[model samples]
Target: MTTLDNGTNSTPAPTLPAKPAVSMFAIGTAIGAILLTIITAISVGFSLGEIISNFGRKNSVVEGLLNPDWGQIWSRRSRSAFIETLQLAVLGTATGATVALPLALWSTTFGNPNRALRTLVRSFNNVIRSIPDLLWALLFVTAVGIGALSGLLALFFFSIAVTTKLTSDTLDGIDMGPIEAANASGASLTQMLRSAVVPQILPSYTSFVLYNFELNLRASAVLGLVGAGGIGARIEFFRGRGDWEKLWGLVVMFFLVVFIVERISVTLRRRLI
Candidate 1:
């Protein structure tokens, strides 16, 4: 080694290689994503525009809404029809929710000790959920004849499917630590679920129930389209006679009732969650 005057040979300072040209890659990716989003939005906008144009030409929607017959809505017959709608919703939701509780519990692995049983229960729940409410209403209407009872049955099945799905999901998402603690303290499965899981998931359960109630209200209003009963029947009656004013009045009344229910649901949900 050659010795320098003062000393020690030092390694040359390592030069940092120039950073790879990643900026171009990042910019290109961002540009591509933006372009894709723009294209998608334009496509959706065009489709919506076509729909709006079609609706405007028909004039059914706007005419019905703007020239609603407020006098008809305030009439005794209309009020009675509205009340029937409310009754169908309330009774249907109550019965459905009651039935759903056991199904929801059975559908979840947390409640079902046997894996095979859990799978079977979950499959059954899925089958129920796959059927749309309108289809259910149509089927029940044929079976029970066109009346409020048919509407109630349709709503009941719909609510049960919805509640079971939601409740099972809520149960699955619950923290298991509390449940384990309860079990460790010599609690039975039922006791653990009642004391620990239920408390944790009650808020979510209540919220789902409220949501189902809102859905049931809308469903009840339209059930009469299939002759299942409620204001839907009244709407269909007027529609057949070409009484656009009365039809519009029923539509407006439905809108008002749904709006009120929505407000109450929101307030209750806020307090809950």
Candidate 2:
């Protein structure tokens, strides 16, 4: 406090606190990341000059990319492949999501009474999630032979992994009041879960299922390379024959379809959540 010109007491302005110093740990981490990136780039023979020169050179692949055959969209074979891809995505999401809910619930302590069973369920979920979607497709393809059946099976397991993981995370945060109430009221385990748990997470579960469908649709294309069956197989066919024009056309159409579906899914998910 200080005396003003008119002899009235006045307070001085407050001083702001000094900012904290950067930590040694953060500095070390940044330096380590930079060193790692440089080493990796060197190991991979990264060359900007080569990349630019390659792109500038006249090549059939580049030419075909520039002049895609748009008419492939009208081809009956392409259309059939597109439909098959859609079917795989739909069926995979449906079946996978259906099984996922039960598995997710059973893995939880409140849902499954047996500790051994819960541990087993958790282990299964972990194993499924650890495997990539492409590997699943490849395994199924080898086991079932080249066909749509393999693609469906691959998507099924993939969907289960995705939806179950997401749903289980949601379950962890649910209100326990309803669950405890149901248990105190002499409800069976299944009854308690149905009345208390399903209602809480159904919206999130549905949103996850929709998101999984999008993933399945994109994955179906790649699965075709393994002969699991879908638009990917057709894409692979064009690639094998050096038909880049047709391949690019299919890619463009697929992009358009994916974009439209993504918009719809986003809208629905926004409403759900």
Candidate 3:
């Protein structure tokens, strides 16, 4: 309130800052994205009507999912397959994660001082990471005979990519004081990393390894479909025979195993972190 010369009180009008204008670039980008999506959908012959019609039909897959043969889990063959899958996951994670630490270190600036070598390693990591686990399974199956060996190899590579990528990220944020001190003390590169770097990142790295194991366990089932040997092979067998009930049952069992293992992994990781 303000007092006027005439001794009358007066109030000033409240004011607000003006809203910022939306950029044309953002609007254009949104419009372009919408247009691209519509074009891609049309190009792919996407049809909502066809989808609805198909869903309305008596689909055996859906029926199988609805009424799965839970008894499949009790079969001796299923038990064997489950064991194979577990073995694959364990072996893959153990081997891959073991090597991943070195690969991760070599890719970093602190770990690998040579810029060219670091770039090469980074490129290699990127290429491997780009390939999905299924593709890796396919490649190994082609190179090696289709069996548990192929699956093991695929999981090994997949685990390395996952663990190395995670460990590298963790390495990036570590305290550099110990590293500088190690360098000033004339420590060797290996000694410096072991003393300064390894201690700091061990917990996070272990957590990543455990996480990688969980992923490997889940991926093992899919790897078997390509004849890499695991529960997926059994799943493929049931699928080939049109035994959707049995397939669904195996799927359910796999899910349960994965869920339990993931819970255990999460608990361990939480403690480590």
- TM-score against native, each model: 0.78, 0.91, 0.93
Looking at model 2, report the run of 10 residues with the lowest lDDT sum. Answer: 1-10
- Top model number, TM-score: 3
Q: How many pairs of residues in model 1 come into backbone collision? A: 1
Clash pairs (backbone) in predicted model 3:
none
Q: Model-by-model lDDT, in order?
A: 0.85, 0.92, 0.93
Ranking by lDDT: 3, 2, 1
Error of 2 at 209 (Å): 0.5
Clashes of each: 1, 0, 0
lDDT of 2 at 39: 99
TM-score of 3: 0.93
Query: lDDT tens digits, residues 155-207, model 3?
Result: 99999999999999999999999999999999999999999999999999999
So what's the TM-score on candidate 2? 0.91
Consecutive 10-residue window with the lowest summed lDDT within model 1: 1-10
- Whole-model alpha-carbon lDDT for candidate 2: 0.92
Pitting candidate 1 against candidate 2, the one with the higher TM-score is 2
Cα lDDT for residue 6, candidate 2: 28
